[model samples]
Target chain A: MHHLRTALLGVCLLSPLGAHAYSVYVSSEKDNSITVVDGETLEVRQVVPVGQRPRGIALSKDGESLYVCTSDEDHIEVLDLKSLKVDHTLPSGPDPELLALGPQGRFLYVANEDDNMVTVVDVDKRTKVIEIQVGVEPEGMGVSPDGKWLVNTSETTNMAHFIDLSTHEVVGNVLVDQRPRVAQFTPDSRQVWVSSEIGGTVSVIDVAKREKVHVITFAIPGMRKELIQPVGIRITDDGSRAFIALGPAARVAVVDTKTFEVEKYLLVGQRVWNLAFAPDQSRMFTTNGVSNDMSVVDMERLKVLKSIPVGRLPWGVVVGP
Target chain B: MNPAMSRSSDWIRILASLSLILSIGLVRAEPLSIPIGLISAERAEYIPLSSLEPRIEDEGLEGARQGILDNNTTGRFTGQSFDLLPVTLTSDQSPSDVVRDLIQRGVRLFLVDLPAADLLELADLPEAGDALLFNIGAMDDDLRTQGCRSNLLHTVPSRAMRADALAQYLAWKRWMRWFLVVGPLPEDRAFGAAIERAAKRFGAKIVVQKPWTFKAGASRTDSGHFNEQQLANSFTQVEDYDILLVADEADAFGAYLNYRTYRPRPIGGTQGLVATAWSGVTEQWGATQFQRRFLERTGRFMTPRDYAAWLAVRSIGEAATRTQTGEVSRLRQYLLGPDFKLAAFKGVPLSFRDWNGQMRQPILIVSPRILVSVSPQEGFLHQFSTLDTLGYDRPETECSIR
Candidate 1:
């Protein structure tokens, strides 16, 4: 499927403007480094040292700079893609765990895990636009495809807060499973999937109704139910399939988007934390925290192709061209 | 029939039909009320010389209250309503009597924060045979071993668990040489024995063992600072050791050992780098959220006992959510079964040890200002769970109850 998507994307986007190599960037929590891996060869390209306690990573729309959340320093550092150096810092509120950029890449929404607020930064102005108070320990941030709403999931509050982009206010709040870690909006913006690490379930919320539509639970053969903690979620561009990173189970569960049923579980490295897809969508990279490595999964084969060793406690991954 | 009488009868008929439909809807959507009972002593006696420790009027009860709020928040969507029936007993009152009253009132789930003897008294009642009790205050290992009850689940970490957790960190640091200093109490001696067992289990050595006979002097008073340094330094004179592991369950003379010892060694076990369930300094793995919630609710930091109690109540809520029933028997069976797991901000899903009914979790080792580490340290592997390495595993269990 991934190969087909890449082929289709190549045929549709084949031009001089589309010719660019892809690289996967991973944030290592303990080692304080962002490891760069070539998307095609699956090799370590470079290891760039960043600030203290770097956990979340996001790339600019044009792929010129990478925004890294240095949680301990209570700020977000921008790394120049060409120089591979942190050139500037954004004043994100205390303890930013994860972040999401607006569709147009004008504003950056950061989840301040320690402060329980979402800091929206106007990227062009290089200033914080607003700090919206949210539920306790807001960690996951997601923006709708249409750029109308942003979703923030609070860990202890157990609610998915929907903030309207225009008003910068929480428009709707949907109660989800316990300890929601990641929220991902569907490509159509009709639904949002929030992964609950402690509840061991994924809550799919209907955006229009602002309520939970389905609760997807993963069950792996010979694995304990508690170990099936769903953390990172990624939906295919066409909204046909979803991949969920099961934290301690060390596997990625593939679910059919239409039916909401789990199709397969692919074994990965130890303590998988987050997932990212290559620009071409032909492969997925997973940060395995315990194994201190990243697993490359072939999207078409639905199998782990290789595990490349990274920094200590690899947390989040992002792919850019 | 008269025209006026017929018009009035038509209006009455419409009103009667609407009322019947509304009554049916109410019956169909009736919420399931799950009542949990909390029993603890009315007052917590303050320990002298600890000026930094604030006087918390309600520690365990406040934590359970927060848990109740959390449960109701999630339970609102699941059609479950959780109610906490907190019954505080005076020193003169009998704990078993309260247990009987709560059982009669339809509270089959309980969180008890009493001493070991009082907890046993409540658990051994005939009327409470079917009740599920959660031990949140007592850290006695016997409760999980020989004295384990079929109906009681201990959320508190046993002394052996803490000892093992600290031992793993010490062993990982290559601090194999320990100077064991025990206080003058029976419980302290038992804790000393647990430390000894941990040293043997983790391949460490207790270079010297001694008991502190000096009385705990008063703090911030006359003669309080007099002879304390001399006494502690004289008592700590022994073979060179990497750390001084104190077994002071009574809180007597342990705090004095820090900075007053003859040799410069890090004090651990009961002081300095102590292993606990929750610490004020732990901000990782989303604990900041819990700490913030707790601080907002109670206006203070959450203690270990409070976290244990909170976990106990949340366990019931999680079980109810999973089973979708408030029936005590079904919930008990499901919780004791191998399938039950609760997420309590410990970075892992916490579950019960089926053999001993002890909640298996990661013990946080913290100093005064920062979180030192969490143990069942690296390279300590178990065939089943790494958390089982900190406590009594299946093979080491004397608990016969399934």
Candidate 2:
């Protein structure tokens, strides 16, 4: 809109120090590069060329560095958060698509899409400590609230494997609906919700017994569960609300955490992919892969307030300090 | 004394035989060494279907192994000896290791059963010059698309080629509208996307898409699972849809969507209207001899995969046979050239695309029960056979190495 014409010149002239202390990294799957954006300014600052196809991005908790798994490269690249230089590299299991970092960023759990295993990396040592076998084509991974259990979702097998964090062995498994993509536990850590992208439902399981107690399905007539394709679900820190990036339909669905009901759909950019919340959970950012842009959803207003242009096929987005 | 004399005679005969064997082996063992390189996945110790519920005719890797042996015997009978040098790749290993191992073994061709990227890695390698790759199981259309390589020859049809064959016959039936039910897997969607493309090209519209969810342990009692009553009451309302297109490539729940389809609709995508290579009825048009020979050799029915294996050997034989000049370079040139064609009984004479090395053939749309139709409808035409209409042609392909 050229609304920031004067402000842009001021920023270009270095009139004020950038307030964007935290950087947002968008892994562009199509273009095969990582676009670094200033979270506050929403300006695409730099593009870092990486491997063949970059899908997942995770920042170190202390904001010292970032890790990206380029699927085709078959390795994870470590980028210094301040210098934005690829400093260290570590071997990951093949075709890593999603990553779940342990609490305090000591260990990184990577879901290798092609291998059907989860690689546990000691980030400090820059080495893979152990790789635990999981279900077929593990697509999503999440650590428990207390970081006791690492849940990895296998898309084809339609199951969630619970790995004991200390032992790094698959302790248990819970069968869910078809194409389960993401695994997340509620704030209380009593329940684990696994989203089935194709099965068109989320299976909420009891963490203790590892049994599925509830299956959540949407009743949007004329839309097939396979096509509805839920991916990258984020529940609020308070655990009252959840936002799911629904594929093909190009919308972010808001769900009531307690009721497990889809409350509403927030129209986002095309192919609304992975999303991340602001530190306070006041806003949500999604990388719209098809439209090559980012959709900024105001969580308080429950609406997509703006769409910012990005690189080709913005896949995984990260919002953190 | 007579027994000792007899024993001494026996030793003389044995000694003479041993000398003869030693002298004969020296010449016979001279290095006319034939080398064959095999690229396969890690050896699997446990088999699910075979271990859990063994079938009279298996459907898993065991079946593939048996089919390979059947075709290998045929190759052996023709005097082409293959010593398998199998290199297994795990999720952690680098694929370039395969290229190096094959080179060390003096392997000129590779029977590749790896992912597309791994195949590409070998093709792109500078040291992998003059090496030919035969794709056994990569069904991704993109491998035939932008990733096509000159040195690679696909024995398996691209996913779209097989999917489109089924769609065309259904379209001919005036199945103007389809209720496209796709599976959740990305691979299925990729194949389904090709079907969707074919449907649009043939003037069929997907009116509604529904995904049936099958939970792992939530097996409904057959008391209500699929009976006449269940089928009739499966869907309360099916709107504007005449046929169902199921695209579950994993076969996870697709088999159920076929005849059990609610609302009296026909299944098209994965189940009812299927396009494939080398169906048993494909023998109807003089393929009877092929079916007989294959069946007799294996003592089992032929699968689509078995045909690909057969075609790979036959293509090489046909190329070698047709070339009167017995030069290895000339034979290789004939196969890699654009003009070479083989009568694989897949329908019209098939040839390699040269660009990505995928075979072009008329796909047979058939079911386990019967043959439905042939794709590249009678009137449709391409420079090659209408089968070229199934997958990417020269202009649209992104394969760079070719």
Candidate 3:
């Protein structure tokens, strides 16, 4: 099926400007490098060596700088998008695992797993703003689209902490399932989806009421429930569809946002950890840690197009325009 | 209307309003306190054969402390507080006396790290009738079966569970034949019996069974390697087998069988590759952060005993947080109920088996350097949870806790 799609696209690619040329950056945890693939061609473009235990990659607002969380080094390495070189370091607290940008992309919220605190960094000024004390082993960070709230999910504490951006205080705490790994807010900021890796459920919390409105569960026939660990959630901009990376299950669950039900499960590489979307949202890229590869999925068809080999322990990924 | 009647009514209303305010103030002044007692009896320390194993002084206690820290992190939001009151008993001290004192001090939750005998003694104490006890050290299968106590819940995996976990993995790898070597200790024989049971349960065959009668020489002596090598080779000269299963719970000769066997067969059970609830080699499913936190707190690798103790305390914490009460009966009911599940970085939510009071958890199969696999292995199905395949299931449970 992938070959047939490629052949059809080959005939349509006669025009030079037929597709968008975005770059996908994947942070390899073991190799200490970033695997950059061309989004248009779906091929490995470069492997840029970075700091130790690089994870949690995110593109800047202007898409000029890419922030990489060097967890072992205890800092965020800023890579220049064009040069693919480390520009400088930002002071992140100990063992930063996952990160998110503020609505304006002026500040970065990093979940410091070791310290149980979320460190907010002023990206432009390259200075620490303040460290907000959160639950134990904070790993997920999500900023509300309206810029009013930031949700950080702590894996051990098993709670989604809603922080008020204005005061930077935990305004509300909603207990989710066990080992909550990722938090993603809806495009309209009405609800936030939190994935519990060990509990094997995704909790959808209402923003206004600060309560769990519904829980979306995944069930692939013949798959053990323990293997279906939900992690690394990506919701579309229109809030119509959501893709959840099921770790160790080696599948991405596509959910219909309106119904909060699983639409389909697309099989991918082994141990898919995190994912990214192209600038145009037409393609998706997933980092498979055990396979040491990135799986490219066509957004419209919800099909895995190909698996491109990457560095060892591919962890986090992001796309740059 | 009479003035005297109106003044009497006003006085009643004022007193009622004042009492309401006082009750509200009292409620605001105190949070629900869940005090857990950790009672451990001191035992003779055995020097580990390998330098990789560090001698930890506060094994179970440190894990309970970390559990308190984790519980309080979530408790701060739920208007609850958790405290661990630990008492380590000397050889001369009595566990019954400790339980009496703790019960008098209003501790209804206990994490017991004593041997099976001492644990049973504490549970039988009249003062502990209302207390809920969690066994963190003992692994005797009989405790979960014929010797089961209605009040006792076990966090440590039983001998049968560990044996069954290993058997499942071996069956998955098609290593169906095992050469069994049993040590002289009673605990070793019990473990050997469990292996026999597991072999029958998992469709494996024990090709040859031999008892290890050679008394180990002074291992620390300069020329000890010569004696150790000969002893390991002499007893392991049996017929060909897929693996050598050693039952050495006392750490006597299990480590010696590695690389010194007559054949090049892999060693398993209490030796080369171990089936345990936790290990240093486990780093998946967010366990790296769990290990890092433990190392940062104790400056040592978390052991199996530590993980068990942590689970015991966290189970209570989880129950308290969910039920919003510290009452012994209510908490116990909530724990054994269907809604109780605690995550211990094992890639699954662990809960108690209502039939046997044993925790349903996946067992880790690990070597000295890396994790081999986790069981219940694939295709080992249970009507309820696949984790049940690693231990005694409901139908096989001899415990009847009403």
Winning model by DockQ: 3
lDDT string for model 1 (B1-402, tens) is 999999999988556434433432322366689999999888757654578878777888888988888786555445578999988898888998888987998889999999899898888999888889999998988888788888899999999999999999999999999999998988898899899999999999999999888786667677877678778888888989999999997676788889989998889988888988889899877676678778977889998888998999888987887787888778878887866767687777788888998999999999989999988787888878889998788888789566
Off by over 4 Å in 3: A1-20, B1-29
Q: Where does the lowest 10-residue lDDT sum fall in candidate 1 chain A?
A: A1-10
Better of 1 and 3 by lDDT: 3
Alpha carbon lDDT at A11, candidate 1:
41
For residues A75-123, write the lDDT of model 1, one tens digit per residue.
9999998899999999898888899999887799999976668999987
Which segments of model 2 are wrong by more than 4 Å?
A1-18, A221-225, B1-402
Task: Tell me how many clashing residue pairs each candidate has.
Answer: 0, 3, 0
- For all predictions in the order shown, the interface RMSD in Å is 7.9, 21.2, 6.0
> Worst 10-residue stretch by lDDT in candidate 2 chain A?
A1-10
lDDT of each: 0.86, 0.68, 0.88
- DockQ (0 to 1) for model 1: 0.21
Best by lDDT: 3
- DockQ, candidate 3, comes to 0.34
TM-score of 1: 0.76
Candidate rank order under TM-score: 3, 1, 2
